[model samples]
Target chain A: MLFKNLFHHFGRYVIMLGSAFSKPERASMYYKETMRQMNDIGIGSLFIVCLIAIFIGAVTAVQFSYQLDGTLVPVYYIGYVVRDMTIIELAPTFTCLVLAGKVGSNIAAEIGGMRQKEHIDAMEIMGVNTAAYLIMPKVIAALIVIPMLVAVGAFISIIGGYLASVPTGVMADADYIKGLRSFFDPFNVTMMFIKALVFSFILTTVPAYQGYHVRGGSIELGQASTNAVVFSDILILVADYLLAVVLTS
Target chain B: MIRTEDIFKSFDETEVLKGITTEFYKGKTNLIIGRSGAGKTVLLKLLVGLLEPTSGKVWYDDTDFFALDRKQMRNIRMEVGMLFQASALFDSMTVEENIRFPLDMFSTLTLKEKRQQVDKCLERVNLEGANANFPSEISGGMQKRVGIARAIVLDPKYLFCDEPNSGLDPKTSIVIDELIRDITIEKNITTIINTHDMNSVMEIGDNIVLLYQGKLAWRGTNEDVLESDNATLQDFIFASPFLQRLRDAALKRG
Candidate 1:
């Protein structure tokens, strides 16, 4: 029964995505909506992304310095460790996890509210493709903006590591910069962008699907919003593990 | 004109509409009246292609609505307009923006032309100068007028209103009913309204279809409603003792 239900939902999700990616009625209207979503997703999320990235970098630097005490490992390796961690793992994974909570639930609630209000049905009767109109712009905006946000997050995290280690006499500023510049592979940056793109697709579409198919009243809408976040977070983590295995191996 | 042939809708094991065949004429106020669970909403949704009937057909003039491909269906839908019970005005937009949405999406009218069209619709709905107000800032009656304004903005050939008078006072309901009636006549558009308001029935029901227990139990005009001997129709129309007393007094006066 559980497997059947899972397959049913998976099938529905795929069909919903097919409709959402279909051709739009008016390109200009869609363009306007896309620009609005870009502003919301990009500008609205900058502060939270920066805050989380800085803390992740600082904590990692402090913990690594503690582990390196009275050991053969160089303290300057703190910079190396924080740089790689923030790029390969922290920036894409943690930032997306936070967004899955903030943006994912919000998309679900917004679309679900429209459903309850009959706004979607009204659009449909107007000869508008409601799925494409509502979901495509959001997906496009996230795809374009989320990678840039992740890039900014990674840059801020490196600066945070330097501040935590070098300013407090834990390491010299020159040594910390050297460690940051050392042994950096360009492939890691490529991997970071790849994860960002994939996570962006998952977070936006999963919540939109939840919102689009929502039925019943406020309680059902609330449940759909919660499920959107939960499912998006779970899928993002699973994708993170899979991407790590594939990209590293 | 819109016609349905043997329309049947079922959800899982329960059937909501059982072979409902009917016609709504062009340039007429057609009302679908029933109690809360009588499948009026399901039938309306099916007619608009929101839900496909399990076994049935809907026709807009000579076009078989369900037989058309996606693009063809959309072409037909472009000529359709709907007003929802809650008014369904996009809350994020001003009244003029809401009314102009269809024009923005489908028409190549210049911005000035669109604004003129919006003004004309607002005037038609007796809501002139409400162009800058948001739906939330308006009264319920004003919001319903906005919904009507938006519905007719595209010059749709067919209009559907799902409970246009649901929450209005009696006087306001009569005004809305009369407004819809006038629009139907002026545009020669096929208009279908789903409502249970008795005042709406007597005032604007040029044609009426009443469903009971998922089947068509009665069909007539506002004139027949008071005189019909159909037991089910009587039980429904005179369900309240106050209405029954009024009916008895009218009969005695006659």
Candidate 2:
């Protein structure tokens, strides 16, 4: 029964996506919506994302330095560890996990609210494709903006590690900078962007599907919103594991 | 004319409409009336292509609505306009923006021309100069009027209004009824409304369809209402004792 239900939902999700990516009735209306969503997801989420990235880097450095206290390992190795950790894992995973909570649930709630209020129906009767009008812009905006956010977050995390380690006298500025510059593979940056793009698609389309087909009243809407965030977080983590296996191996 | 041939609709194991066939003519105020759960809303949705019927055909003039592809269906939908019970105005947009949305999407008119058309619609709906107000900021009656303005902004060939007088006062309901009636005749558009408001039934019902227990129980105009002897119609129209007495008194005079 559970497998059947999952398959049923998967089928519906695929069909919904097919309809959502169709040709628009008018190109300019879609462009306007896409720009609005870009501002909302990209610009609106920048500060919170940067704040979280800083804390993740600081905590990782703090914990690693304390653990390396009695070891013969070079103290400057802290910068290397933080840099790789952020680029390969922390930046894409943590930034998307946070966005899954903030933006995913919001997309679900906004679309679900429109469904409940018959705004979608109004658009449909007006000869507008509600799925394309509502979902495509959001997906496009997320795809374009989320990778940039992850890149910015990765840069900020490296700086955060340096500030936490070097300013507190745990390491010299030269040592930290050398550690950051050491053994950096360009492939890791590619992996970061790949994960970011995949995670952004998952977070956006999952929430849009949840919202567009939501039924019932406020309680159901709330449940859909919660499910959007939960499913997006779960998918992001699973994708993280899969990408690590593929990219690393 | 908009016609349905042997329409049947079912949800789950339960059937809601059992072979409903009717005609709503152009330039007429056609009404679908029933008690709650009588499938009035479902039938209205089916008419406007919002929901597909279980096993029947809907003819939008010469077009078989169900036979059309998505693009073709959309072309038919381009000529359709609807007013939801809640108005369904985009709360994020101002009244003028809401009215201009369809124009922006499909019309080739310049911005100034669009604004002029919107102004003309607002004036026709008796809501001039309320263009900047959001739906949430307006009274329920004003919001319904705004909904009417938005519905007719494109001068749709067909109009469907679901419970347009649902939450308004009697006076406001009469005004809304008259406005819809005038628009139907003025534009020569086919208009279908769903309501159980008795006042509305007697006020603007040019062709009334009464559904009961998933079937067509009665059909008539307001003039034929008081004199009709259909048991179900009598039971529904004069369910209250006061209405029964008023009908009795009116019948004696005739």
Candidate 3:
């Protein structure tokens, strides 16, 4: 019975979305909503992203430079390692993990609170499409801004890594740039984009489903928020590993 | 008119609404009076298709509600207005925007036309010039009035209110009740209210249905209720000190 109800709501949501997507006006509203959601996710999340990226970059460069020990593994290769790791894994996938914890929980909580408070019902009573009016924007925003944030993360980390690698003195500035440029792979960039796209969809859909299905009052709303973040974050990590295995294999 | 036939709803093991049936009249204030756990709110939700009944049917003017498609259900909801116990006004929006929400959603009315309707509804609720105030900016009674204005702005054919007078002084409660009753009469809408407040039962209860433990125990008009021989209803009515004296005097004469 639970499965049946879940499937029914999923089916209804799909059909409603199919119709909305076909309508230009509705689609326009979706674009606007997405932009609004993106601003909320990206702009509000800047501080955390920058903080994480700088530390991860600096730590990675310092560790690699120290391990190299003036030998075959040159200190300048820190930039290459940082670039590869950031573009391939950290920027798109790990950053999304942070966002899922921050933004995903917030979206779920706000929507769940609205549901508990009957504001969502009131919107339905007033003839607003709850999914289109609420969920679409967040999905759109995440898709658009998450990729850009990934790029920004990549840039910040590489710079932090360069600074961290400076004291090692195993390789000169010219050698570091060459190794960094040499390590750049188009396949890794595509991988980053794919990861970003998948993360955005997962974060938006899971949290939205959780929020929409929320029952009970304010207390339940808080539970929904916590559940959305925990569940989505776990799924994202699992998906990241599975995708990594599939691509690597 | 709104009608429920053999509607049954259960939350897992506990049955909240057993085979219950009742009709709410058009252009009259119909009150569903019950104790706290009597499933009044559940019944209200079921009637409006918010919560699907476990068994039986709910009809809005002879049309079985659950039988309709999503589009049709949405269409039906547009004609139905509900006032929640908390007034349920959007905390984010001001009174004007809240009232204009329905118009923004359903109608293609110009901004001017929407504003005009908002002004008229606010004035009708005697809440004129409070349009710019947020829900938190106003008193609880004012919030209820804003809720009523939002409900009626769409010119709904049916109005449902769940404990509309739940948290207010007696004087303010009466004012809200009279406003709801006046709006029902003016629009000729089928108005159903779920409340245990005895004052509401007396103020605007042209028709009353007494729900006892998820079952329709007694149903009658205010006059009929005053003269009822039902012990359950007598106990409920006499729970109020003033009504107890009135019931005792009337019983002595009988």
Candidate 4:
């Protein structure tokens, strides 16, 4: 039944896509929605993503250092620890977890409210494609904003790890920087970007699709919002595992 | 100006519009009247192409609405207006923005021209001074007026209103009904309104289509409706004891 509904909805969007190419106003609305979503979803949540990154980086650095043997796993390699941990896993996947919590629920709740209020129907009646007008802008904005958030988070996490290593007498600043410079891999950085891009798509489109399909009243809208976040979060985790295994293997 | 042929729409096994066929003429207030779940709203949606009929065709003049391409259909839709049940004003937009939306979509008017059109619509709906106010800042009646302004902003040839007076008080409902009727006649626009209010049916039902159980049970003018002897429509009409008493008294006088 869900698949059937999905097909029906997809066909509706195909019509929207065809119409969008010919209609400048539709395209303008898409840009407007993108700008609105970028402000609403991305900028508003930046502080929280940054805070989480800094704290998590500091804690992970402290924990990794405690387990290291001074002779073999030298304290100078703490910079390598921060870089690898951030670029490999923490930045792309976990930051999305945060966005899935904040942004995913918000998109769902908003679209659900519009649906309940019959705005979508009104749009249809007025020759507006609701998905093209409402959903695509958010998708484009999310695609742009999420990668930026990942980059910011990665930078902040490294700074946090540097702060954690500051009081440690064993790790010299010069040695840490040297380690960071020496171990840097273009492949690792590339992989991190690929992961961030994929994560952004999953974090954005899935929640939006769920939110777009929401129906009935306020109770159902609340349920749809919760469902969008939970399902997107789970998908993000599952996607992370698959991408990690596939990329690293 | 609008005609439905054997329209059949259902959700799962439950029929919402069961092979209903009807005609709505131009230059008048054509009201669709029924109780809740009488397929009044469903029929309105179908008429406006918000939902495709399961097994029927809707014609706007000579063009089969379902057979038209997106561009052509959109061209047709541009000439049409709808006032939704919930008002459906954009929460993020001010009254002026909402009124300007349709014009912005379909017109090549410059920004100043758009503003002029917006101001004109706002004035028509008696909402001239509330241009900057958000939907949340307005009362239900004001919101409905804004919805009306937005709907008619493009000077549409056709107007579809679903429960225009649904949440308003009796006096407000009359005001809204009168406004719709006045606008319909003034512009000579083909207007179809979905309503359950008997007061509306009596006040401005130039042409009224009565539905029962998703079927077109009766269709006639407002005067013909009170005089209609069709049992189902009569039951629907006289369901209110006050109306029933009025009908009985009229019958006695005759």
| Predicted model with the maximum DockQ | 2
Clashing pairs in 2: none
> Which candidate do you rate higher for TM-score, 1 or 3?
1
TM-score of chain B of 3: 0.96
**How does model 1 score by TM-score?**
0.99
Give one digit per residue, the lDDT tens place, for model 1 in B1-254: 99999999999999999999999999999999999999999999988999999998999999999999977988989999898999999999999999999999999999999999999999999999999999999999999999999999999899999999988999999899999999999999999999999888889999999999899999999999987999988988888899989988988998
lDDT of 2 by residue, A1-249 (tens): 999989998999999899899998789999999999999999999999999999888888888899999999998889999999999999999999999999999999999999999999999999998999999999999999999999999999988888899899998999889888888899999999999999999999999999999999999999999999999999999999999999899
> Per-residue lDDT tens digits of candidate 2, residues B18-37?
99998988998999998999
Q: A1-249 in candidate 3: lDDT tens per residue?
A: 999976897796576456434333245446655777778898998888888888778787777777777678655576788789888888877788988988888888878888888888887766566866877777778888888887788778777777666645655777667768975669888888888888887787678777877998777888888888887898788889987888777
- Comparing candidate 3 with candidate 4, which one achieves the higher DockQ? 4
Fill in the DockQ of model 4. 0.65
Models sorted by TM-score, best on top: 1, 2, 4, 3
Model 4 C-alpha lDDT per residue in residues A10-70, reported as the tens digit of each score: 6864664454334344556567767988987679879998999998788777877887855
Any runs in candidate 1 off by more than 4 Å, and if so which? none
Candidate 2's displacement at residue A230, Å, is 0.6
Clashing pairs in 4: none
Q: What local lDDT does model 3 show for residue A111?
A: 80
What digit string (tens of lDDT, one per residue) describes model 4 on residues B128-226? 789899999999999999999989988889999999999899999998999899899999999999998888898899889999988888999889986
